[model samples]
Target chain A: MRKIKQWTAMGLATVMAMSLSACGSGKTAETTTAAPAETTKAAAAETTTAGATTSTEPVELKFSWWGGDTRHAATEEAIKAFQAKYPNITVTPEYGAWTGWEEKQSLNILGGNAADVMQINWNWIESYSQGGKSFANLEDYSDVLDLKQFTPESLDLCKVDNKLMAVPISLTGRLFYWNKTAFDEVGVALPTDLDSLYKAGEAFKAKDPDMYPLALGEYDRMILMVYYLESKYGKNWVEDGAVSYTEEEVKDGMDFITGLEEKHVIPTLATISGDMADSLDKNAKWIDGKYAGIFEWDSSASKFKKALEGSVNKPGQEFVVGEFVKMGDNNGGFTKISMAYAVAGNSKHPKEAAMLINFLLNDEEGVKIGSTERGIPCSAAGLKILQDNKLGDPLTIEANTKVMNYSKFTLDSKFEHNDLKANPDGVYYKVFGKLSSKELDSAAAAKELIKGVTDTLEN
Target chain B: MKSKGMRKFLAENAGFFFVLPWLIGFILFKVYPFASSLYYSFTNYDLFNGVTKTGMMNYNKIFTDSDITRAFMVTFKYAIFDVPLKLTFALFIAYILNFKLKGVNFFRTAYYIPSILGGSIAIAILWRAVFNTDGLINAVVTAFGGEKINWMASANGALFVIIMLRVWQFGSAMVIFLAALKGVSEDLYEAASIDGAGKWTQFFKITVPLITPVIFYNLITQLCQAFQEFNGPFLVTKGGPNGATTLISILIYNNAFLRHKMGMASAQAWILFLIVMTFTAVAFVSQKKWVYYSDEDGR
Candidate 1:
């Protein structure tokens, strides 16, 4: 009887705990709604005008983006500063990690509860634009926007059909980053061209058979590197005129990566997919001075630098970017808009929202707030602010400068309108990686890629 | 008499009121979504553009899509390997706990803790840590003078790791079995012993037969859970190493949200539902031959 009573009490406690959890989730949702309401109310007041004179009514606008904690903190600080300057406007911020951002944002758009302004990626532009009548054309407010303040190349990324659709936040390019201490200890000079890169990889392997020389992660990065080489060799696999790859070009790209795998200079397919983080941890390759280099975006240079500096296990460690591959001494590597901000078409106060966007991108105070948070701001005015503040890493600055010097003004060409609704990058990486690792041979890989691309196009 | 009739009416429907919140939630969250998804399974419904009927194209595509085939195979492989192993482990652990041993509660708690955190991200990260190429397992193997194996990079290796993770969280089933064991009368074991039955003989002839119903219940529940397993593969392996670990759930997620092919995703989900139902029905049909119930004589 005592045991029975005890069991009943335990069951009751479990029930109570479940109820409390439900209530807690409800409270959290409510708080989320309430926080946005405060901002919206303030925004409405800032936009409201009195008779004869334009009275700045309090306005509140919700904006959402995805980034790490550092990015989040910087953005929130920027929003607070923007709000203080406006006095009558309130800006609410919503952000999450990158993994689920796309899905969450798409659902919010579908549900018609998406923020007034949102930070969007280039790949999403075509999809969202095709979804019909969802975004306000920034061209309508051309007077408010200083388009000339941004580089033509950066501005081109914002334009869809020759009309500015969104404001670019950053100019990004991919480059090779290596552990300086590791390379020095191994007594190997940094590689300049594709041949030298391969040679350096071989040397690193000869020095330490247990370590992987090239810390390749995803397939797309490899594909991008191959494309970069192909482009330098004067072959555009994804020519503007054609949607499909010729069999020979496909074979060439496949064989290149596969040959590397055959030599075992690259990590095993499992190590790349499974133990990537462990491989990077200080006590692992990066600290032990085993791995030599990594192919990463300009933003990641800071992270790689920080990791080496913060490692407790690795004493007196340093890392830096070697000479990056440009199109030539005269031509630049690929540069595109990394992210953009757009006003939702269904916003209650589109003009007011546009003003807020203008303030965020153009105003000196706004530019200062944005700085590194928005990834080397796209506007010329914003760039000036960053240059004055000396905000970004020197490597990033160098990368941006190189991009500016050699790259032609180009929009986000990236097969944006391909009915193949497939991210060519994803398809290329998966197919090529599979082929190169000998998991699937050249012929089988070709068949799979063709099938995937064709199916996506037909659909 | 009329008042009594009215009282009967209220009594019969009282449960509706008692569970009103759940009923409302079931209709709004579950029933409504299920119906809409059923409709969507036949349409070209991108979430943003809304729904447009496209006949059976999405379903037709599923038949030919290599990725879908791979996902189905992976899910089935997981179910076949994971379910029986988990059930056997659960039964063994529960049988051990049935004994009146010191620190049994502590052991039970320790076993249950993994199940509590089984679906969490932290556990998934831990799973990766233990199974990665240069991870603890590989390090230990290397220390023993064995060649370092990359467990997560190869197709078979990654699947084995995932199967082990599912099997490790068998505590819920074990607890149920433990409860069922406690309910079996002590007199039965004594009776079996008097009949000259050995311990194994007694377990097979008495305990096994008596608990066959609980075993059936567990089998059905675990099979469903295994079929719906997503978090483990999605987080631990990310359906990678050349899409070796892509399950139906992840496929559905990618189609609906990632690719914005909501229609195709919905169809995939319904297909999964059908697969679960068919397996469950088969289990129920087989149960009649073996499951033993105490109330059988009365029935």
Candidate 2:
């Protein structure tokens, strides 16, 4: 009797363990059973978009993006308008600030539970969909999406292995933006070139010890290094998915950053870290016009302008777009797709997701509502609507104009890989950070930088 | 007869049925992840890509990589500084609060509040605010004719700030110590006084021995917690001005989520787990010499 009782207990425990281990297969079975229903929904969406009688069947989609409050509000309103047009379809909006959004979205994609439509960074195509599988091929849904509204160059930026992974929303580039009030307070003319920028840094230091001509964060320092090297060498930062600069060339770029620090052209890493603000726009010194200029994205011009305008020390500060200085004979900046829309490959309603993308980019109502909140629209129709209605932020348009007209370099996707650009452990962060702290000299920093990037590439 | 046998079995196993939900949760959430991570530690699982078996590669990298070495050193330094300082601070405060005083309950609650809110994001942000260059600490320093210190910029300063965060959250340990202190009999102090011992002597010779068991408990718990510390470093210094405070937990997180190297992260986690377990085992082995329980045959 005792032996039978012990055997029964052991058997029950085994049953529990087996059931728990079978959980993954059970989930797969449930998903397999649900596929037919999703297939029917896709068929219904296709027939509706094929100009047949529109289906009254209810369809729900999840669309997610990350942005500021203004962009979130605009996108949410556009989603509402989309729902109004497609009354049978319910679009759930998942939006938040940019911080941690990438990680969350990446996990969602990996878990096979990504949103139907998502606002994705350009590098995500290379990161999450490198093999052209994570995201739905946009070309397949071109019937509903109207890919021609976007330029071929913009479209090319989103393609991997002949598959359109995402549709580019807008192109953006880094440019200098100066606080005119801060420059005027320092009694110095705005810097137009590298020499004058150095002189202005001296002038600012002489007049106000706390003020500096410009401030570039660690990642910004990396970008500027690339720009400097690209301008001098006239080569892409990364060529054929490898570090293009030699050890000596990388040393020169690192030296340039160190020289800027020595001349007080930009604050040291210590100063920026001490500010305790995660981004320049939120830094108190930036708002108060102590850090007179920033090397920032044209898409983010309005945010800094607004932040300075709300400054308590110098309210209504004049924040103007400044020209990109020539680091070498060539122009120093590269234009990048600021953001894009992509549909998950596993989304149940690809056609409907394409329709939502189309409505946001090509539909007159959606375009008007969105305006240039996410930078100037890449879509020809969308840009025309914004231009005709005069609905764009003037500062963003000016900065965008400068960025588009000046930048000639190509930015490789590897430059922004997570391992290379991550906050602390990233190559850019560690190498530049060590340099700023004087723990690694320019020569050693250069070697480390190249080695880190090479290691990432090889892996 | 069969019904009676079924009833007997059900009655005998009632306690097991009562704990079934927790058991299921433990197996599903804890055991599964623990086993899955172990399996992935020996593979090349980049989270997004499918897993590929690569025996010992991730472990080999952990042992050889300079970055991991730095991370382990930083984590060990953090544990060394944090555990002892926190335990001492907690014991000191608990000793003070053990005295009869006015509105002692309010003081206890106020002191305990930090530990309650210590692990939260808000507290981490508050720490940043307090230690930043222009923060309140600097304001106070400057008012006293001192210069501002870059607390979050320098590697040492950043590590100090993180240690301070851990030390400031000594409330839980203090509460545990307070309970242990209260349980110490007044008769021991009286007997010590009759033997011409001072108050300090009484505390050292009498009270401390009785509370060694609790001290051992707090030490083990805190040592483990310190090894796994993440929020303070992650939110405050973000593991650096130059990777100075990049603890193992932060490294694991960076590898797993940011770098997408789940296998590497798993390997790092396993190594950290082993370090903690070894420390705990050593502490248990060493406690036989120092820790005295009243129920033991010491007298």
Candidate 3:
């Protein structure tokens, strides 16, 4: 009986603690979820919506984006300038790093609690705008959004089911970068072609066993495989919302990856994962030059270069742009609208939100503040302003030019589906992990990969 | 007369009004979600497209799914190894610390600190750092003229690292055992010693029997916790080097959030709930065989 009493007390305490934590998180979600859902169908957004009514009304618009310090600062400044013009409209800036931001935003959208004007990835348009008007039609607010300033192709990329869902920010694609200092120290020339790249792995390792020719994650390797397939087979990885690779083709790609591992061309995923950094930019191995190269986004190339600055810790670190590794005859490389600004369907002030997006992407004052913060802005007026001011980052410009000239295949959004990531139960992660761990050979892992991708497509 | 009785009853039962806030929260926050998940398990629920009635599709698919089966096997393997070892270590530490020793309080706090920090993402990162290829473990090993080992890269090594993280957090179970040891009556042990019992004999006859209930409690709770373990695998190994550490909870979460298969995820959760409940129920039923109750039968 005494034992039963103590058990009861302890169990009750545990339950209370569990309930308390749940309650705390639930209360926070509730407050946040309720704040963004007060608008109704504004079917006819006329001239009066943009220029006339509610100018004097007190409006609090939440605008959110994910970026580094420069982008955040520039966006904050643009909001202040917008606030100066429209005194009654208070635009609150919500920004964060990119890690897990997409998932958080998806949850926010599900709860009808997304910001009024938010920065969204290109693929989110397909995911969220499928069933209903999940995003405000920018066409309705074209009086402010200025569709004429953007090219039809740029505008078309953001449209879903003929609704102007989002606006293209800039074009982005992967390109190669080499750590010149590391290569020089190892006394091995940087690998310019695929065959040479594979051979460089052994050369670098012989000089310093800690050094790897490249460090790419599962997703990075996947992208490389796509590039390889397009180069060799003249086919994109995905076509018509499905993986277009044959079992043999996928096996070839898998073998190629495992070969790279066998040849020590790239560090294994397990080794790179040890850093626990969100991206290669912050990875200590990459920073310290133990890892010598990356196949990464041109827009994000600045951060990698910045991380490689010849400074106090790793002085005399020289960064150099490398040509894309010639995997096949085609050497596939492509760019897409990296990110876009979209207005929430639940937003109370759709026209005003459009105004804010327009200001940031078009207006001279907005351009001055947010210039080149979001890569080279895809908007014609925005680009002209940045070019006139000579404000584009040189590395970004050079890298984009190189990739666009060489890259042949176009991008497909379905490639970046969450299932393809290196997470638990993720198809690519599981199959690749198996291949690397030698639990399954490349052919078996390839069969698993095909099945996984097929399942993802079917679902 | 009935109205008078009702008013009298109301006055007597008025304390329920005071508890109304908690009761309301429990029903809304806890009970509602719990029931809704049951309903969701039968439907096709996607975050953007909303729910569609899908009958037993999700439940049927669960059996055929290879990942689900693998996850279940991995989780069982983890629980089977973790619980008994953790319990033994906790009880042993409790026994040692039960002795009168100098600076024992400091030792207790230091041992308990890892338990406090062990469940978080930061701790998971630290675990990864400790086990990574060029991590502190390899550094130490190499310093001693040993070859470096791939601690987080190999399937077995990753699983072992995650399990060690779980085992290292034995302080909670240890503290409970310590409390139970303290509660055992001094006279019971004294009587055993006076009756020509040796130290080991006295401990087995008096101490172990009295603390059997505490052991049962720790066993049940730790077993459930081990089965549902997530953070260590999710953050450290990410259930990898080939899904060797993919716990069922990680599978369930990834299925829902990453794959956007809410209905299937709900089905998986219900399956997990039933399994954990069955384990706990078995433990409770078996307790009568070995667990000794101090106040039972006029003892």
Best by DockQ: 2
Evaluated on the second chain alone, the candidates' TM-scores are: 0.92, 0.95, 0.91
lDDT of 3 by residue, A120-209 (tens): 988888777754388898988887777777889878878887889998888788988999888888888878787789778988889877
Sorted into a CAPRI-style docking class, model 2 comes out as acceptable
Q: Answer with 2 or 3, whichever has the higher lDDT.
A: 2
lDDT for residue A175 in candidate 1, whole number 0-100? 65
In model 2, pairs of residues that clash are none
List runs of model 1 lying over 4 Å from the truth. Answer: A1-55, A130-132, A151-153, A161-163, A232-237, A276-289, A325-333, A404-426, A450-459, B1-24
DockQ of each: 0.31, 0.42, 0.34
TM-score-best of 1 and 3: 3
- Give the number of the best model, judged by lDDT: 2
lDDT of 3 by residue, B88-202 (tens): 8998898889888999999888888889987787887787678776778989999999988876566667778888998999999999999999998888878877888998887
* DockQ-superior candidate, 1 or 3: 3
| DockQ of structure 3 | 0.34
Candidate 2 to truth, TM: 0.92
Q: What does the lDDT read for residue A264 in candidate 2?
A: 82
Q: Candidate 1 at A123: error in angstroms?
A: 1.8
Clashing pairs in 3: A333-A407
lDDT of 2 by residue, B125-228 (tens): 78878988888999999999999999866678889999999899999999999999999999989888999999889889998889999999999999999999
